[model samples]
Target: MKNMSLVIGLIAGMLFGGGLAYSGMADPARVRGFLDIFGHWDPTLAFVMFGALLPMAGAWQIQKLMKRPFADVQFSLPDTKKIDRKLVIGAILFGAGWGISGLCPGPGFAGIALNPAPALTFVAALLLGMVAHKFST
Candidate 1:
């Protein structure tokens, strides 16, 4: 079962990576271009997001009929999920980094696999931050 779980995770990651590659989303520069408000803002990312979300929305509707939850895991539906101060602060930090570097965790990790130069540095910094957070918190 553990092996199966690992296999499933691997397969999911592969599929996600492939899809991102196909959609040109794995490149964070594309994401930064999309997020650019004052400059040239590309809408392809938004359209792609909607295309992906449409099917997921349908699947969510179908999920209501399932007798048991997927993987038999308890899924707690969040109640009153409102944006708070933490969310705003995090968003500011995230937006600032994204705008400056055009890199996030997903593409940073993927770029490491693809042997990109700058992404390697970003991944190293990200890992260090994660480790530091673990000890600090």
Candidate 2:
């Protein structure tokens, strides 16, 4: 069962990385273009976002009907509902980082294979940020 889970995870990761690469999202320049609303804005990322949301919306609906996930004993969902200062600050920070680097966690990881140097730098900074957050909390 553990091996099966590992296989499934590997396949999913590969698919996700492939999707990012194929969609051109793995490129920071492409992502920055999407965020460049004032000049040479790329609408491709919007389509990608919508495409991702469609399947996820359906999955959420499907999850509501399921007693438990097929691979898990129980559904592991976010329990937080409150919007506090920490949440707001974290969101602002996340947006700032994404805008500046044009690479969030998902794409950052995927970029490691596509473009190693920049991705490694981003990942290292991301890890440092995570560690800082852990210690601060």
What value does the lDDT take at residue 11 in candidate 2?
93
| lDDT of each residue in 100-119, candidate 1, tens digit only | 76777776777776658888
- Across 56-81, the per-residue lDDT of candidate 2 in tens digits comes to 99999999999987776788899989
Q: What is the C-alpha lDDT of each candidate?
A: 0.76, 0.92
- Provide the TM-score for each candidate, comma-separated: 0.77, 0.93
Which candidate ranks first by lDDT, i.e. highest? 2
Q: Judge candidate 1 at residue 108 and give its lDDT.
A: 74
User: After TM-score superposition, what is the CA distance of residue 95 in candidate 2 from its true location, in Å?
Assistant: 1.1
Per-residue lDDT, model 2, residue 5, is 70
- Candidate 2 residue 10 Cα shift, in angstroms, is 1.9
After the best TM-score superposition of candidate 2, give how far the Cα of residue 84 lies from its true spot, in angstroms: 1.3
